[model samples]
Target chain A: MLGSEIPVFMTNRNTITEQYPKIYLYRRIVQAKLFIDANYADNIDLDNISDEAYFSKFHFIRLFKNIYGKTPHQYLIAVRIDRAMQLLKSDKPVSDTCYAVGFESLSSFSGLFKRIVGITPSIYLMQQQKIKAQIKSSPLTFVPGCFAEKNGWLKNRNFRETKS
Target chain B: MLTKMTHISINVLDQDSAFDFYTNKLGFKVVVDVPMGADGRWLTVSPPDQPGFEIILTPVIRSMYSKETSETLRELIVKGSFGVGIFTCKDIFATYEELKAKGVEFTKPPTKEFYGTEAIFKDDSGNWFSLAQLT
Candidate 1:
């Protein structure tokens, strides 16, 4: 035991014991992120998870966060919020938006919305409404044209398998 | 393909303290705290539930890294060179307070970011980490 008194949580790194091969589980972590995103609210217990990705809840959370800059919960929340944003733009009621985006309560949804978007749902909606009105009067589609260049990024990425 | 985060490395004076700060304090589980060689420990941690990612609680300054490179890393650690904080905490302030109570010293308290709340703190051996709550 050390002087400061926090015991070593796991000292023996036995190769044969409860351990997952690093590379094998690394791939599973990526898979876990995808699985969790596709089925966040679904029961994603470790045993039921497809790979080691879902094996440890805490382990998956760390891996996802380190790679993606957001935890699984945070990523899921962002997905929900993004959906809510679209709903709000289409004249959806705030409560409807909240529910449609998977929130059980509007208050919690609003709080999260403020935390991420730096404004309340009402304010964001109002701003979107004004922007839409201005766009409509200007004879221009309100949707911002994605400035995606005709870069070979997509081709390069997709063509990896075919490349020598 | 930058498909993997090789490992997050931290340089601290003592291995055990670094392990405690990351594991017991910050909620990371000891992924691998085995021996590097005869003299040094190769401590690592990942968010307990998340196994893919890892941070090497490396006493690199005291280990393989040369004195010159170690000094540069030490300077970066003090200057808060490692950008952004708050990885996957349920709450920012709560995590901050928990670390403070556990004797982790902060270079700066939680700062608001476009992404999330972040706090910079040093481990017992002067290595830095970002406690970021992503946006």
Candidate 2:
């Protein structure tokens, strides 16, 4: 009973049939964002992200930027910077945190970090340390070593110091 | 004291389109359509049979949310991750067929379940709803 071809109805500009493609485009854009969110820590590039959404890079980039008001690269950087902030908060060394957040080089990581967060990693670490020192009387609680290691945090202080 | 839900919100990708979808396809009645600010409207709609509760068709605009959050909400909506709620009809089969004729896309055709005869349909922005004739 459901196999028959339904006649296409077009009553107005807001018809669901007319809106389907636009809705599909929105879905593709969301898929692209989900892909970036899931793989932000990996070596993800624009081509692969667009591929994940089954759209051409140019089309995906345009739609993503139009819908989200930011380019895919900008979103990726935001995601990476957010991860880097968490790593830095946990006292991970600058260089380790850079690679852990998927930056190819220290210079690029530092440049973007300063551009976005308005400070270099070391300076940010210093600020975090100052905050921690102020709250030291409350007894610092470290996330368990297993969770730390799972998040790519170096558990050994000497290793972190040497890397820094 | 406010003890019951008088209004609920359903975030839509666009307010104008949502107005059409809810009013034209789903046969909801517009409750309010007043201007809110420079670019927003206080748009709300209610089901034909239910007038006391209004569903606010809020848009995911820049003024309402940050760019990241707006984008995230749009993503969630398009991914069909948000289920607005279940709507009850007198006859599930009749309602399902009537909605389908009105261009609503049903993800699941009417089926008999332990609870009732249930069907699923998606709105213009990909939010799904269960239209059921509960037992």
Find the candidate with the highest TM-score and give its number: 2
Model 1's interface RMSD: 23.1
Clashing pairs in 2: none
Which tens-of-lDDT digit does each residue in A48-96 have in candidate 1?
5534544566666676676557876777787678667767887788888
Instruction: List ranges where model 1 is wrong by over 4 Å.
Output: A1-164, B61-63, B67-86
Q: Per-candidate TM vs. native?
A: 0.39, 0.45
How would you encode candidate 2's per-residue C-alpha lDDT over B6-113 as one tens digit per residue? 788798998889988998678687765544333256577899779989897878773546789889999999999999999998655445555665689988877655
Model 2: residues with Cα > 4 Å off, grouped in runs? A1-164
Q: What's the lDDT for residue A35 in model 2?
A: 70
For candidate 1, the lDDT comes to 0.60
Could you tally the backbone clashes for each prediction? 19, 0
- Please write out the lDDT profile of model 1 over residues B1-135, one tens digit for every residue: 577664655555566766777765665755443332322554567885578777766564553457897688767765656552336665555455556655778876766655666677766655566777776
Residue by residue across A14-130, what tens digits does model 2's lDDT show? Answer: 323322335556556766766776789898878887888888888888888775567999999988997797788778999999999899899999999999889999999888776
